[model samples]
Target: MTVLALEPQPLAFRVRPQADECFDSWIDRVAAAHETTRPALFRHLGLEAAIASLDLARGTCGLSNEQYFAVYQVIGQLAWAVEIEVQQIEGTFLNVEASVVLPRRQRRYVCPLCWQQALRDGRAPIIRKEWILRMSWRCQVHALPLCALPVADGAMSEQAVGSWLSGAVARAESLRWKLGAHPRLVEWNAEGVDTLVRASRKRFKGEKKAYVDRFQANLFHFAHDRIAMLALAHSRVGKATWGFERLVALELPGRPGREVMTLQPPKLPPRRWRISKGSLRPGSHDAGVLDLVLAYAHLRVRRDA
Candidate 1:
């Protein structure tokens, strides 16, 4: 007897993407809602073949032109399977030249308070798009530095991710009580940096267009160069465990203005910073280093404005 292949169909219980949710986060939530693993859900949507075409190692943040096409193809199928428009799915993807400004694994940082609040509100915790950006070390809503969890090099089951987040949130709450406040893991103005990032995404027209373009280009160049320099200095120090606080304390050459660097770097022992697994492109640095670089970039844009 011959068996027929089933056509992909819309899920009966679809989970809509939350505001500013990451694509992967949405996928995980959908899978959980359907009581299936992410891989199984992909298989149901006939996405296994498309997944093979994608360079998952490059992550979802910085896709090459070809990779972008491949990702969009996959997103199209997923949108169809979930009964949503392709544009809605695309909105979850990073729409910036973020390869150099995001961690290799992406989605490793989560705001504990945000996660807890989501649970309290009877909503599934989501990995916000902003949290994936290296420039976003602190949560704007909570005004707290986002907590970093161990990087999962590849895909994780929704159940596993949920468990990991619960543990992370518990730890954060414990730490907060012990410290009597959120530990100043890194000193940087999250609102300023976030505003700069948002402004970069805006499109100006006609006369103002050329000026905006030049401004964005200069900001990107400034950020790229400073990130490279900071990564180099970090490498020369011969300590992978050096936290941002320690690195800043060294008064590394070409440090930004005093206004941004006002706080004396805390004399904390070097904490082991885990490098997310992947082959990063030249000049693309780790998230920890990128945080400082973006902070400096924010100062540059403000001064030049």
Candidate 2:
């Protein structure tokens, strides 16, 4: 007997996001570009099954693998006129977050300079991946505090958010204090540190690695074993990996960034120096501090080449 084959399904929306963009922002822009609402798009993508389990409009992990492809196919067919590669648009950014749920940021953040540039280029504002990580707060590129996007009640149209975007950029630019922008953030990412840590952890053989999730192994050594911290921090041509064992031996300190790198702002816009000094308290040593450490960690990752 001959068997009948089923046809692959298509998604409702036809648009895709630009590079380094987040799924949340991509969906909203797609809705706006298509002159439709997200709820309407959701209904079209057969995403109802995953909707209750996720905040489909605001989250990156909203849809399952199955649903993601259904939506991807639809958007691909619609946006075929554009030059984007579908794989890079979705499910392509690798991270540890997929297996673990991370707490949400208390406030929204956007880069004013980035928004201005994206608009100039005729592209939607790209939502960066690092901003979703709790460890990120400042925009390294503009050396500015990421301004907040006021949260609206559910289903606010994309047009409303677009208007809010312009206001948020103006507000972020007028801010009293912000960090000096890193000149080469185009080449920086936290994932590079993740790769380094993964390589370093191989030295442990059978040791527990949960702490590696935060690059805590190096910090653990820096805090509890100053001697090893001293050694590892003084990276050499080929001996850094040898110090990994000694590094993880120690308990952590109250502040690891201070131990790793006494990070300082690069260059402040004139008249904002006073505010920048107060806003960035080195002693508080929070995620912003972690950002420095992670960036420094990536610098080391590049040395492998």
Candidate 2 vs. truth: CA RMSD? 13.5
User: Each candidate's lDDT (Cα)?
Assistant: 0.53, 0.44
**Clash number for model 1?**
0
Estimated TM-score for each candidate: 0.53, 0.44
lDDT of 2 by residue, 159-273 (tens): 7766766775554443312223322321222333334322232322222232233332232222332222222232221122333433454365876645344322223233311
Steric overlap count per candidate: 0, 0
Candidate 2 accuracy as lDDT:
0.44
Name the top TM-score candidate: 1
Candidate 1 ranges beyond 4 A from true positions: 50-66, 104-106, 150-188, 191-305
Model 1 global lDDT (CA atoms, 0 to 1): 0.53
Give the alpha carbon lDDT tens digit for every residue of 1-305 in model 1. 99998888888886888887877778777877787777788788777655644434223556668777766677788878878887777667655664423544445567877876887798877888776654454467865546666666555565776787677665444333222221221222343244444535544466345323322222222233332332222231212222333433345557566544554332435445332334433322345454454345334333333
Name the 10 consecutive residues with the lowest summed lDDT in model 2: 268-277
